[model samples]
Target: MFVKYCTTLFAGIWLLFIADIAHAQQPLPDKIAANKAKDWQTYRQASIADSKMAVYFRALTSSELEAINSAKSNGQSKANSKLIEIKSELTVESSIAGFLLFLQDYDKIPNWLDNANGSQLIEQITPSHNIFRIQFSAIWPVSPREMLIESRYWQDRQGNVHIKVEDASDHYTSHKNHIAISIIKAHWLIEPLPNDKLYIQYRVIANANGKMPSWLANKVALRSSWRTLKNINQQLPNSDWQYQKLANILEYQELIQEPTSGTNEQTKDIMPSNNAELN
Candidate 1:
């Protein structure tokens, strides 16, 4: 009874923090404000105070919050198995082609992603769709985790790139020592912004699929996400991403047609829309 009470208390505090973060955004620009008022009522601003950029998270159900507090009791259920959703944005100085090129280098993924033990390309199902496996290292008492992910990427007519990442653990046999994560739905939105900057938005919903405590898993998820963004911001400029290229993408085709064409000038008036619409 005491353990349950403590869990409930901690969860209450966590939700309060979520509520605080949701309302902590600096003033939004007109377009973003309009989108927030219209399509993003369920999302709360989760970014740091006074920052122009904002991150958002959806409110979790009571069962979902319970699952996070104690995985053994609630996480095994089919309904409340998923982790909390995280949506974040990063503005970085990189061309669409360069960023795509950086992503295509699969082996280097662990360098930027926190807690990643190994990242490898399993098979190239298609030029844009491929299967990869990632190993995640956890602290003592929690078994290490592994995921087989199917990544599919494409570009829109508006010159924005979208990558969908999903769990594909059933494709291969599971390892003996690693806990296989069974659910993952993640997306990456790389939009071309004005002044040669790219507005990158990433959203992920996953489940640990193991006996690890939910609170610890949630903590790791949030911190790793923020760290990943920071790493991307720091590492993108260090490489010559502009000179790098992938021939399969539409942006690369457009570049072939007009080598001198600059950034997506039409997207200047465009702000990111609610990511829920992508589903």
Candidate 2:
């Protein structure tokens, strides 16, 4: 035959390209231990503002203060006082599965997420839940904006992890020339301190609904949540996202069974011992 059919069609395309690179390097089955376990509450012990950022208050239930004084006496909406909950705290050395795989990598989130020009991952509702989208880059005379969040992360039983973002923009479908961040509430606690530290806490609140002004949307959400939590704690001590190898993240399975005594420590810990003071 034609050279044995071209060597069996190049050995079946080289065994399907090594089985698609072993199914893209496997290891993504953690559905938060069958979900159900969120009741996260705690944000009333302020004092984190040596420029580290804070002002994430909560407490409004008299029918939400009579629907924000009946929408400020029917002027309609100020978008709930421009909803601006900002928060930040730190203590790094990262490893809660390398900062939750650098916050589940949504296309590497515009590299470091400062103004986040773009990001995507429309849906993956499992390996710890997902449904994302991000875009934002207009800062003068305010305009460009986007968000379709619906994140979810979990892991408790002492070894904390949280995550939890909202506002799914009615489950997808967006983008008609930006502008659509009606409201979004966010959170992301990591906590797992003691030696190989990691105690960061982040918070957010949004409402760039349209006529942006609540003191310029809380001064651009407090300098963009303090430079996006100081650029995710200075990019989590980049050792390629600090050894990104998540397998149900038990501290990366004990740092891959003690990688030579956690390799000389230091992943940028200490320096944000309570930082959120802007009420």
Candidate 3:
């Protein structure tokens, strides 16, 4: 009787252990993956909307200045020069579609964008292309005023979306210092990832033709870029349900392929997403 009891007890323990392992290795649910994909799509749309607003503003500002110049040439009267002193100093891009979503309402630009005081959509050129004009107010030490910015967006044959921005402040006269600056060029590329996420990459090469100091220029570039990224990260979640699910599956797969206990060097080498291996 004692021998039979011991065998039953050990069998029960073994079954429990197997059940726990199976539970840990279970795959993620389908609903979680769908939700995560939807969220990523929203993020990307927002980014595209912001770029469109920038492009539209740039063109409008340029046209207004041209009209002023044409009037002056025809002996209308010298226009105000102080308007030219204010500069548009910030450019931003995001992989999340949230930017475009905000644009649909047209009143939320100032809320999400750091320095934008006001914005308006001038035209809808196409389903993929749009034009928007934005007026940004200086934060401080820089005069508080609005400068026009224009932006354009289109996808290439490779399905890569590209955004181009133009600054139209050059056409107007600056009453403050007769200085003018224009956006030489800007680009934003969105790369889609697994589970509908996107990797956003942005690059801008701008020229300041005004008599501004080099130190100030560098400061603006660094501060603006850092602030934009910080804002995006704060707004977006790092790990949604789908991300957590994927991580769990990956960890389980790793364990199954090399089930070992203790400070095993071999296990460390096979670990996924290990930074040590790259180093």
Candidate 4:
């Protein structure tokens, strides 16, 4: 009971922080304010209206298709900037619970996290949200980049998990001799389907800080997203992770529900919705 209270308190405080961040930019025009309010309301109702989540993923898929329909490359973008948006989709042949477990188990994520240096947990914040120190190793001359980030996951009323992981280096010393990413926002939409299938859509918008060409950055971003998606597709169902079972699912659910256990890892939660509007 004590743990539950603390968990609720932390969650509530973080929600307020998120709200402050949302309205931080003042002088909002009336129309923009109205739209923001409408969007907030829609998100609040997302628990019950998971169709919004479904539509969101579908829209992203459609946007990717636009280039193909117009006879252009899928990831071709004329806007040359430091920031890039890369996305990929995958269908995990497992139950919703199993798919989520695969994500939450950060220590074991490298089993399918594509070709990368590695990822280590700084703190397991509420199973759904946690801090991770990751190494992004590229070819030589580029050196290796290390960063600390916080990933938070939330579930809709339909039992789908939406994830948002952002750079949290403000609290840690930046790694030297490597280009640190100044801005990175990764969003994931994991929805449950019939027959225990799970649909996942992952989108990443990032700025690889330092002197890097826009074309190269764009290529790396797109390739990384696609590679990760492909890895998950080929690895998760065939994985030997025990969390794939119903018993393990229930055990994990219990852990999330435990107030004391939550207290051990509770931290300021910065949800993805705080940074980007999903719909």
> By lDDT, who's the top model here?
1
The TM-score values for the models, in the order shown, are 0.66, 0.28, 0.43, 0.58
Per-residue alpha-carbon lDDT of model 2 for 181-203, expressed as tens digits? 74445678877765666778777
lDDT tens digits, residue span 33-148, model 1: 21123232223233332222345544345555555446333223232423456677887777787887677677888888777878888899776778888888855556888878
Question: What is candidate 3's CA lDDT for residue 59?
Answer: 15
lDDT of 3 by residue, 152-208 (tens): 443332333345555545444333522233444455554433434445555553433
Q: Which is the better candidate, 2 or 3, if ranked by TM-score?
A: 3
Which clashing pairs does model 4 show? 3-259, 4-259
Residue-level lDDT for 18 in candidate 2: 41
Cα lDDT computed for each candidate against the true fold: 0.63, 0.58, 0.38, 0.51
Displacement of residue 51 (Cα, Å) in model 3 is 21
Which lDDT value does model 1 have at 80? 47
Clash-forming residue pairs, model 1: 22-45
Candidate 2 segments whose C-alpha is farther than 4 A from its true place: 1-87, 90-122, 132-147, 150-171, 174-179, 182-191, 195-198, 203-207, 214-216, 219-247, 252-257, 261-279
Q: What root-mean-square deviation over C-alphas does model 1 reach?
A: 10.0
Report model 1's TM-score to 2 decimal places. 0.66
Backbone clashes, each candidate: 1, 4, 29, 2
Off by over 4 Å in 3: 1-106, 145-147, 169-181, 208-211, 236-279
